[model samples]
Target: MKDKPWRREQRFYSFSTDLPTRYADMDTERHVNNVAVLTLHAEARSRLHLALFGRDEWLARTHALRPAKLQTDFLEIAHYPGDVAAGVSLVSLDPHQYTLAIGLFQDGACVGLQECRIGHWHEGAWTQLPALLLDRLQRFGLTEDVQ
Candidate 1:
């Protein structure tokens, strides 16, 4: 499937990290292990959260945003000992819910895509997102020019 065209008009918050694929990340077929994809998704999500909220302590003390679901599609095989760039985009917005779109690119080609749904957890329940949190997320959406 083709990737959705990024809506560049919205402001998207992004961060890039160079990740080295380890030997252990390779499966018997000689490509990066399927399980390793989850680790990359986790790392990307953590970085995006940190960029938006500043730090883990800040999140625990103030923000109610929590990941509710994650889905990933592997478009191509990634080999061990290679570098990958992960780009995250805010694809949709809602008061209580949002979706983050992540693309793992290698050599300028997308190797995988991940979509994460995040929701606010409050008062022992998943509640409608607070205005403050929604405002914070809006800043992470990609700008029209960038998309």
Candidate 2:
């Protein structure tokens, strides 16, 4: 299988926003605080999830997918008052788990990247993955070979 691109496939659901760095987002050296990166990740992921699974889906599902782990890497520093373009992608799909990637870009350059592993609860416990959600995610462009 071909390796998935570092970026999300265009067909997959995506959410973009201009995230403004606030005073609290800056540190002693006047750069965007490190914690802000995680905030951006959360925003991107939330937007994507809400878009794919509407509010009703959340209320109706017995066990919804939740983030099991997150890994983030920062490539550059962004200062307060600056705005970043954040985007999210569903990159991998499995029977019980899926992977999502998010990117923060400034001035057309990527400054940060994050990947998350998500899992669903089944049979009274959380499992590796769920086939039903995987199939639904595939329609949004996630694939087995994404990793």
Candidate 3:
């Protein structure tokens, strides 16, 4: 037999947020669409952005983080009548970019896993991460209590 592409996962993240599942996110098959899952990841990432960089600066785009690449693996189906939580972890760091892994969890199970690379943008160009930004990124972890 050929090697399996996906395997069992045992990973956690630093930040997490409960996300709403709406009728709009469901499809005819009664499952959340891939597009909706991607949106959920964005929502979680936006929270991280707000935490690391402040709301005003994030909104004003004084510094920006653009998604370079994204990949997702759907593991289970998420049902309604409850909220799902996206757990985000900063996996790797570079001078100008970083990688994040997110787990979409519902009913105590991870429905999906997402990995994305985000690059810094400043002065209309992708720039290296500043000292302050890098320091902040390195300090993030799952130390805070989770609900």
What are the per-model numbers of colliding residue pairs? 12, 5, 1
Off by over 4 Å in 3: 1-11, 141-147
In the range 1-147, model 1's lDDT, one tens digit per residue, is 134544211123266666667888999999887789778876777777777767864467345667898778887788877887777777678877888877776666677777888888888898987665677778766423232
Worst 10 residues of 3 by lDDT: 1-10
- Once fitted onto the true fold, the runs of candidate 1 whose alpha carbons sit more than 4 angstroms away are 1-14, 57-64, 130-132, 142-147
38-94 per-residue lDDT for model 2 (tens digits): 898787776676566666764455355677888887877877788888877676776
**Each model's C-alpha lDDT?**
0.70, 0.69, 0.74
TM-score of every prediction relative to native: 0.77, 0.74, 0.81
Give the TM-score ranking, best first. Answer: 3, 1, 2
**Stretches of candidate 2 above 4 Å error?**
1-15, 59-64, 122-124, 128-136, 143-147
Error of 3 at 42 (Å): 0.8
The window of 10 residues in a row where model 2 has the poorest summed lDDT is 1-10
Ranking by lDDT: 3, 1, 2
